[model samples]
Target: MDEMTCPKCGSSMTSRTLGAVTVNRCPSCSGVFLDRADLADLVEAENDWHRHTGPLTEPLPRITADMTAPPPSRPKARSYIETLFD
Candidate 1:
């Protein structure tokens, strides 16, 4: 297969489709290349989505366990709770 060079990172670009448009995408740099019509279509679609979206919408925050939070202190002795409760 023919390979296309990524303009940003010099990596190989692969073809990816969004809706009806085919765009050249660079996996390494996460870049998308589109022609004039393709860009226009993307912008129009984005605007349409924003226009129809509710004003109260807020971007969700990424949820991750706090690594700095000390790991659960292992019980110094086997708890009787597990044996009795079981």
Candidate 2:
């Protein structure tokens, strides 16, 4: 495939395939780009994942002042580009 340049940063972008869909991603800014067919494929892939994984959240625990838990430490947030390929 020919190298594609990022429209936002002018850096070279890399191609990644998720199932039958191929997307271009910018390494510098973590941007994702997809064509119409790829977008449709990605949407279908997301729906399939949701059908298998069910809801992503769990039931909230009982809330009380004394029982309050410390704020959960967050990991570095991943971009949608990273998520789509994973």
**Residue-wise C-alpha lDDT for candidate 2, range 1-86, written one tens digit per residue:** 67899999999999977668888889999888889998987777767665666446989888977886689896532433347655
Q: After superposition, which runs of candidate 1 have C-alpha atoms over 4 Å from their true positions?
A: 55-86
For candidate 2, the lDDT comes to 0.76
- Per-residue alpha-carbon lDDT of candidate 1 for residues 5-86, written as tens digits (9 for 90 to 100): 8888999988866576567778899787878997787667666666665557789666678635557985532332122112
The CA root-mean-square deviation of candidate 2, after full C-alpha superposition on the true structure, stands at 5.7
Give residue 46's error in model 1 in angstroms: 0.5
Clashes of 2: 0
* Residue pairs clashing, model 1: none
lDDT of 1: 0.66
